[model samples]
Target chain A: MPVAIGLEGSANKLGVGIILHPPHQTADPPSPHDSAHSDDEAFSTRTQKHTSPPVQILANLRHTYNSPPGTGFLPKDTAAHHRRWVVRLVKQAMKQAKVQLEDIDCICYTKGPGMGAPLGSVAIAARTLSQLWEKPLVGVNHCVGHIEMGRAITGADNPVVLYVSGGNTQVIAYSAQRYRIFGEALDIAVGNCLDRFARVLNIPNDPAPGYNIEQLAKKGKVLLELPYAVKGMDVSFSGILARVEEMARKLETSQTSGGGPWKDDESGQPITKEDLCFTLQETVYAMLVEITERAMAHVGASQVLVVGGVGCNERLQQMMGMMAAERGGSVFATDERFCIDNGIMIAHAGLIAWRMGFRTPLEESTFTQRFRTDEVLINWRD
Target chain B: MAQPPPQQPLRTLPPPFNTSAESFELIAQGAESLLYRTTFLSPAQPAALKVRPQKTWRHPTLDKRLTRQRVLAEARVLVKLSGEGIVAGGGGRKVKDPKKKNDGGGDNGGVGALRGLVPAVLALDWERGWLVTEWIDGVTVKLGIYQRDLAADEGVLRGLLGRIGRVVGLLHLAGVVHGDLTTSNMMLRPTRTPGTNADAMARAEEERGEVEVEGGLEGDIVLIDFGLATQSVSDEDRAVDLYVLERAFGSTHPKEEGQFDEVLKAYGESMGKPGKVVLRRLEDVRMRGRKKSMLG
Candidate 1:
């Protein structure tokens, strides 16, 4: 078995995981160290056959750096937080997996499309481990990590991936070795919009702003009107964010002036924070579902795999389920353990690449802030 | 949440359509609408019926709102483009050739140049999410390109590409954007004498062979499937519209992709000054990869 350890600190979350890929019975073992192009065809053929043993997650642990209510985490502070805890998390993860330093075959880390400073910190940790342990390194695209992990956990083969996170929102489907983007957010991401709205509303960041909003929204009955912008398959959320922020401000002022709560125009019923949360989720999730459905229709795909932080929202999952069912398909999603930013996905995705003779030399082991999902050649899939 | 029991088979003809379902033939079922081939009033006059089906997943109110808005938007654009001289008899304009009145003359007395280039709207029932238009009798550019092997002849391909560009240019010049600009959305409607269907049909078949060689590319380039069309004149919007078509051409007809430049050249000539700016903006859009960076 080849084991790989992954470290992730793309944002406020810092995760460390250990994964093992069991050896195939009939096939020759993959080269222990990086073997260049000779093994490429054979590796791809093996993957295409789907003959590799099921991946085993030996250990997956995370520590989040939460900001105070009404505030968001900054890159500088988040980087410092990751630097302070990366070593401890890694050691703990290794111990929990009952694996020794010699047992690890590779060290993987998130390579980018995230906060610059945090991504840099995690890359440094990965580099240090690789040099110290004399193991090869594998850099993973954060979004691909999510998609691959989602597929592994849900057993969704060749699904249209709806990857939603604070930094990115995209609807992707695989074609000719690339996870081509079908649609995406044209402005701020859906998760970013919700997180920003949560700040304006002074929502707690204990669990997560998005999670808090989802809870509050459940109690909300009024479906307040908000700007809905769906352009072709893409969506724009900045307008909706601006409109909701203004509404929040008005509600705050009304309460401060002792003028009573804001009332609905037609019903004269007082509006509450819950109502705003409900409206935001309803409108945005609806947009997400619509775009996903469009991509599915265009590609003639039946299965959809929702991944990333926003994928954890029950309401989103429910809405997606409804849409998929209408098309006589089904939706696949994972719990926050895998959906939210995590190291296990990085380990799993990186191991797949490593198995296919991929490696990141120590000198070239670095992270980027603008890596695109489609930039990674998905050789593991058909 | 419990999944709604399996979707009921889609209604063949909901409400208003039920009365005339027997006369209509389903031609295509698009993502948002169902297109039926039928006649308008008389059996000789063919028409297309587009119905926006209600989506069960969407809230009834929202579904109704979107259906009504799209139906009206498409109708409005068609009506505006027709009146502007993009379509023959669109503005009720007289043809330049008095002798060819029954032939549906290709020339309209200068509304904005390209005449008979769009389908004329005959009627609309917004409440029922249906609209009827004069049926275009011809093949789609996609099929025409495939069946004729348009790429085999450089001159013929260029002419066809130029016509596509000119028609789209006029559309943008008239302040409308066909949101989805795939080759399949356009039809190559052959010209004909108004009353001689049989003669026109025979001539069209003969012309198809000649079209493969002579490079005359003679026909009206009629745009269809206005389901996603919008009224927008902004240079950015127009550039994106053209970009969409450019991508569609590359994907659908990779062999002929290099000839798309003729389309842009013709588009530039037809659009004049604004076209120059839009073409320049298109470069920027292409360089930026048509989509904004995913990272915040």
Candidate 2:
């Protein structure tokens, strides 16, 4: 068995996790969550023969850096927050795992495709730990970590993946040892649009902007028109974000000026903030689902997996389920524990790479901020 | 004793044209529609019937709205282009014909013709969500290129590529942008003689395992599948259109990627000055891969 400790601070969230990969054992009962495809005989047979040992999560913990309402987390502040918490989180995680120092095999950390400061903070912590524990270091791509973790948790074999987050929105499929991106947001990412819109409404970031928007959307019924821009499988959200922000400004001015409730032109009902949230979610999620469906049809894939932070939205999952069900397929998703940025996914993906004889020298363990998902060679898969 | 015949499964189409099932043969299926080959007006004239099935997953109102909008958009673009080409070629417009020698009659020097470059829209019904157009008989540019032998002479392939660029230039000149410009969306119809059907060509290529270089790459490029087309004259939109085709070509035919500049050269020559501006904008689009960098 090989045990790896993964550290991640690619964004406002700082996570620490320890994983144990037990040797392959025959007749090991399939995980209960593996019900995603229990009815598909072909998928079961195709996946069973080459399935790697199911990963064992020893300890996974995360701490988010929450800025005040109307403000986003800055790189400098977020880096300081991660630096302050990384040591404590690692110590707590190791203690929770109850594993001796010698039992650990390697240390893994997110290397790139994130904020420069936060990634650097986590990389430094990982380096110190690796030197102190005298373990090898594995650098992981943050996107690949999310993907591998989603697959391990959901057991979706050969699925077209829709990855949506604050910095990225991509429709991906595995082909020829690479996670090829078929289409993506042509401007701002779907999550970035939601977060900015939340700021416009002065919504608190206690949990997450997207989660707060989802809550507000649930109370909303009026479907105000928002610009829907989708080109082939690719989507654009900057236009929608601009229009919503303007609407928010107008709504605030009317309320602050002591005017009567802003009545909708046709319904005579008061236009509320919830309606804006509702419209934004509906339009953007539809675009995401549409692009994902296009990718599925293009690749002739029946299975789809949703991963990344925004993947935690229940509405997105529901809409994706509806789309997938129409094609005689189903959607697989994990809860916020795995969907949100986490260290376990980094540890899991890194460990798999480690098993394949990949290593990062001390001189080459630097982090970057602009790595693409397709840059990583997925050698672990066929 | 009398014996009864077994019942065959019937695939019913959407209303108004569902009575004749024998004439409709499913040809291709896309994300939003199903395409069928059928006869229109006269039995001998083949036509393509594109039926946009109602998406059950979406709200019924939204589904109907989208289907109607898309069907009308495609029909409008096709109709406009189809008319522009004939006006330039047939009536007193003295635009030099690329394929045939023109007997000069009247001067309409500035007009761009799309004749024989796009399928004519024979009929359409936006409410029922179907559009009928003249059927194009040929293999797609993707298959034509794929079927060509790797060791064959590159001149024919280059000529085909140039024609594709010129045709796209004419489309842009007519103020239309093909949002999705992949090789699979373009058909190579043999001049004067109808070539093999796209499906039959694939089967023949697979069986023969050889490229027939004599006439493999000669045809008039006909653009099809206008579901995502839009009427836009902006250089940015034209550049994006070209960018889409460029990326599609690189990914689909990596072997012939080096020769893609032939497309741009011909496009620039056809459009004169405006095409150069679009090509310049293309450099910017290529740097970002159709997306701009955002704050992390």
Candidate 3:
């Protein structure tokens, strides 16, 4: 039997997975995330109150922006980051699996649904490694990987995947034998809006800016009516972005010396940081819940799986849980490993595909940054 | 279940000069002609035979000229489009007409033999007015399960488009237009590496690259059926050719066609030198196509 290692380097995340099952194997869940870490020494222990089932964190690492902030990391720079981190990450993952290098069978990687520059960089590296090692590689859809990882961790085989990320925010349903994109952002993502608003607010791209913003929204008291817009399955955040800018600019201008509205009180029923945080949290999470409810009604699927960096929001999860319960369906939320970026999902999804005989030839080892989940034919099924 | 073939007493003539063993089994009866499948029991040899009905050509003088030109055109186009004939199936160069002079016109079999197009073998009148050519072994591009079965096989699609773009470039360079460029016309050939067998073991001692590259690749791609094609010097025609290919791409293969950029990218790369003028006009052609679709 051939041991297959999967490599995923579509964007900044460099991932590799190994699958041992054969194409002839009977139907079973691939890489079920129902086990605790094979070894616990490699991680820093952090305990939480909720006892979610221990996920099989089969070796994973995330290397964020080596390049300085301000400007987005160019494609070449991102690829360089991948080339440096991939080998090391894979080695660490193997150590956790306690498997030798060659024991790795096929390598699976993300081909696209990302930037072309980043995609090309990963492509060259993957193609070269596969050629030298003579390993069959499988290119996977990044979005699909997110969805699959969400399912693997949550055990939701057919939940509507709501992917909310820095670049993408969409309410997707599996229909017509493909991922029919039911709703999406008209312009920027909810994350992008938050990041830009944070830029205006001088908020860093910290892991929990959403959580931090939620904190500040608590202080805000004045009923600052902001734009709330949602069209059909699609949602618009430009209005939200514009509304925040207007409030900020208004506050700044009024306090600039002359007899302005702010000059009288310096702060009129001043919107506290908590209120802003609460309002932002309420607004965004409400929008998410609204769209998710709409998607459940649309797909007739009561269960919803929220997967992405944004899925970590407590308010978002709470609302989705409330919505799911109201509809008499379950809401699946991935643990931190599946929520924040990690190689585990790639490994999880890749292993499933490898078991299903989705192998790649050497000539096609290029990375695809923008692979649509709907484009790939599902190889694994319930 | 037991329907008999045509009643024409068109003798059991095998398409000649093909390395195949079995005779040509006559097929499809056209008002003006007929088609045939040339079968060879030998695994190594492959070919096809096409035959037209008798007295289909009313005018001897004009029919002779047109058929002669069409056959010559197909052969000429194949020469330029097919690389030193490396990856292409060796086309049938005009051989001696074996039909009796009193029997009249030669077989009009060479209409689709252009660029080692994959469809037929021995595409010419071996005895009289018959077209025969090499038979290809592959599935239709539409049926290629590589993408579905193998995840990283998107490159195979790109390579196919690259082959298409390169061939289209060749035809355009020679001022030829393949009026139809659809999924059915494309075949996915297996890339054969050195295989070891007793016969292959015996042949291993034989040389490499064998200056004689006759029976090797079938030229990676066999674009079949150029019967509705034409050779011209107009940019309009060249753009139309691409339009046909692009449209066929969208309609025939919807799921896989999402990678249409690969085709255009490859086309942009291969059509580098001669594609300058026509490439510029391609924009206009696309614009006009969009306008026409909207209005119509």
Query: Fnat per model, in the order given?
Result: 0.22, 0.21, 0.00
- Range of the 10 consecutive residues with the lowest summed lDDT in candidate 3 chain A: A46-55
* Candidate 3 lDDT tens digits, B35-128: 4555544645655554432332122332343345434434344443332232223332333223313211222222232334434333454124
Give TM-scores for every candidate, taking all chains together and pairing residue i with residue i. 0.82, 0.85, 0.51
lDDT per residue, candidate 3, A15-51, as tens digits?
A: 6544343333344443333333433332344232223
Please identify which of the two predictions, 1 or 3, would achieve the higher TM-score against the true structure. 1
Clashing pairs in 1: B88-B116
Output the better candidate (1/3) by lDDT.
1
DockQ-based ranking: 1, 2, 3
> Which residue pairs collide in model 2, if any?
none
Second chain alone, TM-score for each candidate = 0.77, 0.78, 0.57
lDDT of 2 by residue, B104-177 (tens): 22433323345456788887888889999999988888888879866767877877787788788888887788
lDDT of all predictions, in order shown?
0.77, 0.78, 0.55
lDDT of 1 at B273: 96
Enumerate the candidates' DockQ scores in order. Answer: 0.21, 0.19, 0.01
Residue-level lDDT of model 2, residues A1-382, one tens digit each, is 7889999898889999988766552222223343222232222322223243356678889999999999999999999999999989999999988889999989999997888899999999999988998999999999888888888778787899999988889888887677877777877889899998999899999899999999999998777767778776777899999999998888888888888877778688888999889878888998898888776766667789999999999999998998787666789988888899999999988988888888988889999887878789888787
- Clash number for each model: 1, 0, 59
